[model samples]
Target: MVISNKALRFIIATFVICLPFISMANPEKDTTIVQTVVAHEGAEASHEAHAEPTDVKSKVKAFIKHHVLDSHEFSFFQDDETGVHYGFSLPIIIYDNGFQIFSSSKFEHGEAVAESNGNFYKINHHDGKIYKTDAAGTITEDEKSGHPTNVRPLDLSITKSVLSILIAAVLMFFIFTGLAKSYAKNNGIASGAGRIFEPVVLFIRDEIAIPNIGEKHYKKYMSYLLTIFFFILFLNIFGLMPFGINVTGNLTITFSLAILTFLITNLTANKNYWGHIFWMPGVPKPMRIVLAPIELLGVVIKPFSLMIRLYANIFAGHIVLMSIIGLMFIFKSWIGSSLSFGLSFALSILEILVAFLQAYIFTLLSALYFGMAVEEHHHEEAHH
Candidate 1:
């Protein structure tokens, strides 16, 4: 009964979110207005570039690069004429001798410097990184290296990525808690929203968890697997939204997740697992020595592969999709513009599949690693 209530609430919340789009009496006219504004501004910016394909290509590349990277502030959309942003700005927190707290809006969408606590900082809009600069805000770059010669503080700002994580965490809490309550109320039978998650939970347990980690030990690791699976799955789905956060696509995020798996797999591993890593029991002494390094190297490679696989796939997808969409503006010709638009639409659909597939693969591999760690080599010991 409570589950049903929660489900209704969720539906209502979704409706509230959709109300704006639905309330629009003439979306076509609104779109036409926006497009008319965009074309007017874009033509002004690229008037000289209209004759030069190289100039257009450079502009497109820069635009796509900017789109894929993480940013301090969250921006849904911007107006070309008045330079108005249609999203909430994030808080900027930096530790430079003392704490500096300010809004990212202080930078005015990266066109200005933000000063707080007598310290001035500038966003390298070129790369979306923050750096400390003088009051005059001068960024000196070394001729040898393109990096700026400026001090950088420890930034603990709640960026779009951080906000997305917090959002996902809260969303999961509500969902799973409601699902749990519903399941409890039904006395083992799935009820309300539980019916939705029930199938996915069972699929993970049956096809991924139990099959990979064995029935006995699977339950022990289910918490970790489920947590990661849902967290990553939520992140993947969130990236598909126009929220300006590419959490999973960020290497730091994938790396952190991979490290967690690595630590859990190695730390919880049984004696048998280490025995296989350091020295193979059945193998000859000389062979074991040669194989030991390879086995150890494999440990590092496993997590590295996990990180790279997720980061590369998501990052590349975002880049390619955006680049193609950017090309629609560059290639004004009907044929080229249509081709780019079609490719972008097709890839957007593919990205949805990839979003789910990556979550599955990461969970599957983590479970496999867990199984290997807990597996007993009794038969091998007997043979030796």
Candidate 2:
């Protein structure tokens, strides 16, 4: 029977499954594994027909991990039964001992090892990393851990995640640039396309930037705040789609963004900022010395929290949402599947709110940090 379901079901399933395949090397032998779900009651199957998908348990875990991790290609969709992928292949570039560039299609959807420059390299399916091996393509296993033990190449391929980042960047460039030009044409007043973004830009300026940083210094830092706000918002919205673009969900991405905030905070800091950390003017010398270490440590802690907060929220949300949708396939029954799907639909809507919320939180906190950095201290008038 066809596995097709309702449009909502299809969307949830599609969202749950359209993960990228890094590439996996199977043995020369091909296994023909089939799963049959009998629809009607028969003489032989009079009691009940219970059919489970092939390797359900392991496949489920791999399915989730595949969606979460980065891959060398962009897989739009797939057919689980036939294992047919309907996505375009991306270019794969590796630097082992020398540079080797080839299309990921060379792997034939991980059915075969890719040969580049007379070098045989296979994909470690277990971890989604490429490994160098002999012509036989033997992947050694570590005794301590059942993981693959093979030398890896410097993989610098344009994967789905990387492509998504570029897409967001290009989109932002055209959008903001157009808005800026429209404002210029209208004699500093928002016009045409600028009307759409004008409210948000003003909100950030009036609500976020001005309130957080004083009016004098707010303009100087407006560019960074607006850029980050939209940059993260685009990524968070992109991730909600079935395309599997988890740019902000990655810790590396979040850490880099946090580092940017940290640098701007400390680098642009006025003397008052350092004075508070090193030696508070009003506080006694002994107390100032005692507080100095804690204040300095707080500087590091601020950015670290920023990194973990964005990463943890986005990453955890994806996992929870994916796991809920995955339960529908596992249930395979009308009632259970319906309940699982209902929950998924609710969470999906909530995720939309979260997408906007995360962007705001990041921007708000960043503006607050800017305020602290550029804040000026007042001293009492000289006493007689």
Candidate 3:
């Protein structure tokens, strides 16, 4: 299962090169485009049309936004003519007056209102938020702010992002457990999928954990470091897939991960770690007092940076890659379209590399923080 570097690169390159042609051959994409064109014309003829127009740039922007947002259902495709969506709906659990559980399909992809316990609810297409409404699904808006005045129930629905996280967690469990079994069965040697992931596991330990956190303390944090590295790695890879699962790109997800690191680092800090922060050994009393608050702020800033770094990189990458691919539709000419495709292909490969890089960076910084927290200082040894 362990692929050589050269072979991996070659496979990625081949896939990139073939992607455009493969997409061109897809009849569903072509059908969707044709339907969009037809729908656009129909909308132009009607004065009260509310459907999305088929302007090339507008459609592209809308598509990107849709992909970026979490949805109530998994939409693989849609037939405009038949007004049918090819997707499965997730359960919608809301607490307004009381608990109301229903299928997302009851909303009919946000085209219709769903009634539960004699209360009607409608999803706002612009923000993807569900709102309480009348039987007609009338969303009252304030004239001054132009914002909805409808009541919003507590939504505890399993959105696309939430579902993706559950999937990733389950996948990691099986993968690592299987790898452990392989090691035990093969006399401490990894077999099957373990062979592929064994090198990466070693890299994190040897290069990241041991170097940053000393060997004496690295083992204590190895489980956490390994878990986070692979967790982020798998989520990043999932975001790149065509399933539109952007778990890592979600700010909430990144923020949660950062919070975990923050809690672990501060909770496990040795006396020396806090001592240097609140009262430095080699510094003046006045300076120590001044630096204490700054060091405390650093604690919050570290995890904040971690959250933003992962979220921004992954989110921006998706936007840029999707925008480049969107250029193909905008450029109708062969030369322009070909150029767009070529740039997209290259960016796609780069995105795969970033998927791993972001995971590594997050893990490395975490290990470094752990190292700093547990580091011991000897005044006599330091003076010598």
Candidate 4:
């Protein structure tokens, strides 16, 4: 039953090694939120912020003056003779009559259009006359463009986050199912795919579950731990790839994971765990009354912390990497560009390790909660 000093020390050392990586990842994400707020404030201070730019910002802009327009969308060669690449990075929805595009690149609203009866109509930005287009991309008479209809395109493309989660889920199903089959075929022992997974599963069973929850109750909690460990681990790794999707970077996904942990913790709690929470045996009656509220609050806060920790770390890392890349575009200088490339490269390597470490921490905490819930209390009198 005793945990050796050496074993305890190793646990401490492992945490020390991984803590900074997780912590750094969070601040980078938080800073972006702060900066966005500040930028919003700055924009509010200027009354003429809506005016068209009288000056060009970069060499590319100076070269392409003619092609660019005051509107967010354009379809011609620039003043500098740079031809428009309609095929590259085209917007999903374009308001051709209104002279605007719903492009992530252009971002700001340049013009507005109206629609009616499954057709789109817009007042031309130049002369303010209405034009119409049908569902099949055909221009129609102005009389037909008077009904309210959806002007958006039916692109139905999956966002990066959704696609990433789907890919991660499929990969986990394949790898773990293969491991399970490998173990089944090898006389209850593992081989092949199982060999890679067996050690980690055994560690969770032998070290985490049995020691914390006791031998009798450990098996009941094993499947949940294994599933969580692998799920988070898979998603984290996928978030680090080049075309990586930040599934855990999403607040909703992280919150759902935390909610599951919360449910399991409460549902699996033995009589003793609840008894201690509501009424401590040795504590004063007056203190127990006050402590009851604190204990109850702890239940909610624990899962909330789990949600924020995972979400913040993943979200922050991605934002930092993207912000550094954004800086390369903003600076337009070799020094800034080269530094951004180097820092992004180094941070990316660190993020890969972090993807594993955060998954382990989340799993470890969840297992600890499960252990607390199912742990059996020994009778002091029987021991004597």
Q: For candidate 4, lDDT tens digit of each residue in 1-384?
A: 999999999998887555323322346655575586567656754432333433223233322221111122222233335533332222424344333433423222214444443545443332222345443333333447533333333332233445556677787788878888876787777767657877888887887777777778878888888888778888888766544356787787899999999999999798888877897657778999999889888889988989999988987887677666555555444655666788888998998888878887787788778888876666542243
Clashing pairs in 1: none
Pitting candidate 1 against candidate 2, the one with the higher lDDT is 1
In angstroms, the error of model 2 at 5 is: 37
lDDT of 3 by residue, 236-273 (tens): 99888876778889898999999999999999999998
Top candidate by lDDT: 3
State the C-alpha lDDT per candidate. Answer: 0.84, 0.82, 0.88, 0.63
What's the distance in Å from true for residue 130, model 2?
Answer: 2.5
- The residue-by-residue lDDT of candidate 2 on 1-384, one tens digit each, is 565569779888765554211112231211222122332325435232223224544456666777777777788778977979988888899997789999999877665789988998887665667888888778898768767778888998888888888899998888888888887887887666657878999999999999999988999899999999999999999999886678889998999999999999999999989988998777767988899999999999999999999999999988899888887765544555666789999999999999989999999999999999999878742321
lDDT of 4: 0.63
Tell me the tens digit of each residue's lDDT in model 1 across 48-129: 4223223445667765665678888888987866969889889999999888998999998887988897888998755688
TM-scores for all candidates? Answer: 0.84, 0.81, 0.84, 0.60
Which portions of model 4 show Cα errors greater than 4 Å?
1-160, 331-335, 379-384
**Evaluation by lDDT, superior candidate among 2 and 4:** 2
Off by over 4 Å in 1: 1-56, 380-382
Task: Give, for candidate 2, the lowest lDDT window spanning 10 residues.
Answer: 21-30
